[model samples]
Target: MADGKNWRRAGYVGAGAAGLLAGNLALVTGSIVRAAGRTPAAVDDGPDPLLIDPPQLMRSTVAPTGDGTLLHVETSLDLDEHPSDTVLVLVHGWTCSTRFWNPQVNQLAQHWPVIAYDHRGHGLSEMGEKKVSVAMLGQDLEAVLTSTLPAGKRAVLVGHSMGGMAIMSWAAQFGANMADRVAAVVLTSTTARDVVQQQLLTPPTLPRYTEMVKPLVARAFVAAPVPLPSNELTSRLTHYMALGRHARAAHVEFTDELISRGSPRSRAAWGAAMYRLDVAAGLHALSVPTSVVVGSDDLLTPPLHADYMAQVLDHNGVLRDYVTYGGAGHMVPIERSEPYNVLLDDVLKAA
Candidate 1:
């Protein structure tokens, strides 16, 4: 009789605990959804404006993967002034196109050759395969390097977000010859793994409920509707997720435009892959001079990722530099263009 009573008591306690956890999880999810619908706080008019006018550049089409996926490549080379031995290749992040690098391109193209391209299923590029993975993105990048860059020329690769992940994937698969053709690498606002587990969607105070909430967060990304409505809610949500608290309305609009242009199917496909991403080995495989940049306020790919990446690269005999932007978010390149441009110039000159 005593044993039976103890067992009943334990069962009741467990059920109560489970109910509490479930209620908390529901609250968190509801909060996120409501936050997405709320209007974003307005910002004062600021002098920080985007560099909208880009220089006229040559356009070319290349089949990087040889899998019938044609990548749209743009280059601005003042062949009269600079040598063709080295070039700067810019890679944009997820849901973004070559246009994301316009500021950098406009600033750097005057001194050196600047090349930018849209990833598969982004911008002008056609979706090549039914299935998408980081490995496939790496293969596409390799194809771009092989076809667009001259035989003996080298490049300083600059990648952001998914673009950065693609670079890591490239290093993992093509690390053997990377040192020869790649002069330096810049990985901005990216990660090597644990993206889903360490995501900031759920509050850290709820450590006990993190595992339970992760799947819900991941599903939200994978199931997000395409051509997101152009409303105050959508604007607020984009600003919240991609930019820092100090972002202007104009900046938020620009980011929302790029994000909304992305294909819904492609977005979901890539989101699924990112949820399960683990490329720590790829970071170690990077043998060239590398710079890792992240915004301190970045919620998606936190600063811990940059710290871990720097640690791994240093351990593997690779000269690495880690930079953090205090008030910036995941969109470091756009949010802090002045510092970012200066950093890129320094890296390119060093390369």
Candidate 2:
């Protein structure tokens, strides 16, 4: 009888703790939303970038890979346009599809041939028998490079978040082939390593007591197969976690929907993979001109990560410029596309 009472008491305590966390999270979300109302004139008054649909239809095809993982590649330009020249390749981050690069693909395709691909198991693509890791991401990128780019053609690779990490992985693993195929590289809202330790959404103070606390919460967040249905709680939490001080309601919803679209198992697998990420060697192997962009309000891979990259890139003479948008967050590409596109255009011009 005493044992039963102890078990019941522990269950009640757990329930009470969860309830408390939920209530506090709600209040914090409200505070963040209210603060976001007073955004800067630059990001505040513009037409929503996320609403910018692709004016040109992108033809989709399966990019060839040696490992047999299916990578869905979308192209807006004719295959014959730049068979031997440089093309703009946009690689999306975790839980995002080729649609994530709609703003870039639409605008850049007018002059430059543009390509964006879905990561394995993220969108229309299927995960093959190979395990998911940063190294595999690199190999998959190489597959896309060889399959999509005709012989003699090079690409200006633009990778966002995990996509950027994949680029780093490529450079580290296939340094011998880096200069032969890639013209230049653009990394935005991403990190080379230690992604879990730098998350702003997870409080750093809690780790003072136990370092395990933060990773435990982060694992629960990325690995949990919770439907994350569109509701007040999910919306607010998404906004707080990713968007900046000036994020619009629509931006939050768009990002949330994309994240929730991934299957539970895929999300869990990739999320766990990030925890083991160690691609510092990849970042150091970058021999081509590389530009790093980050948002000041990015809660995931914060500016500290960018600063670290700048140090390494500068040392190697690969640094172009380190840019930080004051009011932007992790969704810098969507939240601040006009200026972001300008930066991309500059890279293309120099390349």
Candidate 3:
């Protein structure tokens, strides 16, 4: 009788404790969900970048860059119902290729035609002269769009990092002409003005020593036209920065292969242009509905930078929706693919 009574007492205490714990968890989760709203963290370790499930129409070809250079480009068609009146053209960042957009291609293509191409010297594209500029990249995009999709059809332009700057450059040069055709713009982990000046004005993510190395790398790339050690070195070093953990081994391997494919000329050109890039005018002039996505933990382009962009647009009477994801670093497209695709769809649907 005594043992039975004690057992019942112990069970009651355990149940009470469990209930309290559960209640606390519920409270915290609710707080998080409320604060974060629609944007949620991506919590999965899935297929590696290289092994990204293939899209329905994966086409590859070399297109004219309008510079007399045959630049390589790739496009992925939707596997599901294709929505006309919209095509999503993805522009990748520094040292990254069209494959970087793989995670979102199929998902976004479901609603629209998704096309991405390697910048002149990145991915499968032809190598060009060193000392690249955002203007040059913008020209490449124009050539690709005019030759392949052109401006006649309505399109949504999505760009990340250097790709973002390239699109802005295109807009700056082309202005309302391009804006009329472009229904929306998605800028991720990128900047609108002189990055060097901005970095100096704000909290520095990469060490000052790292900035010092930029000019050196650019010169070496332009002069020698040989792939620099820094490209591979940085790739190996920052492989795990995208997500909190090292991406699946396949992701690392695929990223390595893609970056390795970039020509020294392209790399150097991009580096030089990056140092001098300033698209504040373009960003302010963008009349299309815009979405700016950044990772809360992004060191390269921190949340503050995204905030600045929003402020810029707001002041210009151009309102842009900003989505900041927690626990994600610079490589957002690959690390948090689903969230990106979902948000992009929402933006597209609204457009």
- CA lDDT of every candidate: 0.79, 0.80, 0.67
Per-candidate alpha-carbon RMSD to the true structure: 4.6, 4.5, 18.3
Q: Once superposed on the true structure, which residue ranges of model 3 sit more than 4 Å away at CA?
A: 1-55, 76-83, 129-131, 150-152, 196-236, 240-253
Tell me the deviation in Å of residue 318 in model 1.
1.8
Clashing pairs in model 1, backbone N/Cα/C closer than 3 A: none
Q: Candidate 2 vs candidate 3: which has greater TM-score?
A: 2
Candidate with maximal lDDT: 2
Q: What tens-digit string does per-residue lDDT give for candidate 2 at 1-351?
A: 999999999999999987766655554434445543433312234356545668776778988677777789887557556543778889999888887887777677777878789889889888877778878899898888877876676789999999999999989988786778888999999999988756777543332434434456666667675665766566666676777866866677678777778777777778888888889999999999999999999998899999999899999999988999997889888878889999999888888
Alpha-carbon lDDT of model 3: 0.67
Q: Say which candidate scores most in TM-score.
A: 1
Candidate 1 similarity to native, TM-score: 0.87
- The residue-level lDDT of candidate 3 at 141 comes to 83
lDDT of 2 at 73: 89
Using lDDT as the measure, name the better of candidate 1 and candidate 2.
2
